[model samples]
Target: MTSLVTDTRVVFSRELRPVLRDPFTVIFSMIQPLFFLGLFAPLLPDSPDGGSPLQWFVPGIIVMSCLFGSSMTGSNLLYEMQTGSHERMLVTPLRRPALLIGRALKEIVPMIAQAALIVAVCIPFGFELHLAGALLGLVILAGFCIGLGALSYTLALASKNKEWMFWTVQQTLLFPLLLLAGVLLPIENGPGWLQALSRINPMTYVVDAERALFNGEVLARGTLEGLVAAVLVGLLGLAAGVRAMRRSD
Candidate 1:
């Protein structure tokens, strides 16, 4: 038990330090969502549902951060592949799953912090939160990050040139998530078929659950259905990523 904890901590520390040291890493991860909240929030039409645009948009912004950070996990895998770090680890006694878990653990803290900040900034813009749901929302968001990060890590292994191809392929992975999730607009406003499609989208589940939770809805009733779907998809994505990585090796 002690060794497991120590191993996770060491890997977590290693993963986190580089992210903290790089200024661009932090800025680029955060800048787009902040820009969306600042510029686009006001442009959204007011709700007859009796809430501000900030209420709806803030959850989406939080989701956007998850979207970006989760995608960036590929970059870490790319670095490992380029530097032969992954190969070195392959020779180590450390459990492979532990390495991935530690990597996911490290990535999630920053994502959660960014999500909290989005909520804080949105307060003036009229975002509300039920304490219980906010807490659960954070968990759901972190779970999404972990699943996506794992997937990205696996994808990076298949990428022949991780650096050059990382950004290009990441855009492809991210756009579908953002569009189907209704980050910038409501899914209901779309066509009936589109709305049905959005329901199955895991990202949309988080966005909808969090948005409802942000409106101070009860944690149990408002979120249970969506949360279940999010958890399932997240687990499936992570499992697929792990399988891909082992196959690549």
Candidate 2:
């Protein structure tokens, strides 16, 4: 058990070094989300819950950051595989699961930093900051990011040869997942089919939880649902990631 922790820490720091050197890599990733906040946000009517659009939109953007930031982590692993760097690591004595877990864990720091930056940017524009609830919300986002990151690594391993396959599936699924989760626009009044799909989309629960927490409603029912969904995703991702790591070339 101690060895796993040590191995994971070693791997985590190795993956994180490049990001530390090039901080803007994280900031550049936020460009799209910020654009959505700047342009798309003002077009929406105030939320029915009596909150301003920024209040409603900012939380979703945070989730969007977590989604995009964590999901693309697979590309890094794929590049490493192509360059033989991944094989070098495979020859090390580190436990297989540690590789996946550490890579996934590395996503959390940037995810939280990006979330904080978004909140700071939005607050000046009248986005309310519910400190306690927002802190809790970050916890949920971190868990979700870890799970998503692991799954991304798994996908990269599965597509080590055909890099396009990773991008193809990612591009195909992300928008549907984003739209269906009501990140940019609410789907409450959308068609029955859309609503049905949203109901089953796990990310939808996380979005709902983010909104509720940002509103200072930490005890809201959506919080429980999102926590559950995030945990399940994390467990499933780690499980799959470890399995994939064990089988990697």
Please report the candidate that would top lDDT against the real structure: 2
Instruction: Report every candidate's CA lDDT.
Output: 0.75, 0.92
TM-score quality measure for candidate 1: 0.88
Q: List the residue pairs that clash in candidate 1.
A: none
TM-score of each: 0.88, 0.97
The runs of at least 3 residues in candidate 2 whose Cα sits more than 4 Å from the true structure, single-residue gaps closed, are: 48-50
lDDT of 1 by residue, 1-249 (tens): 557677768778888997778735765787888988889887888778766777778878888988887778778778787788877886777666667767767768788778777788878767776677777787777777887787777667778465667677788768777888899987777999888877777888788877777666755553876577667756876677656655654
**Candidate 2 residues 119-169, lDDT tens each?**
898888789898999989988988899999999999999998999999999
Give the poorly placed runs of model 1, Cα more than 4 Å off: 1-6, 20-24, 162-165, 220-222, 247-249
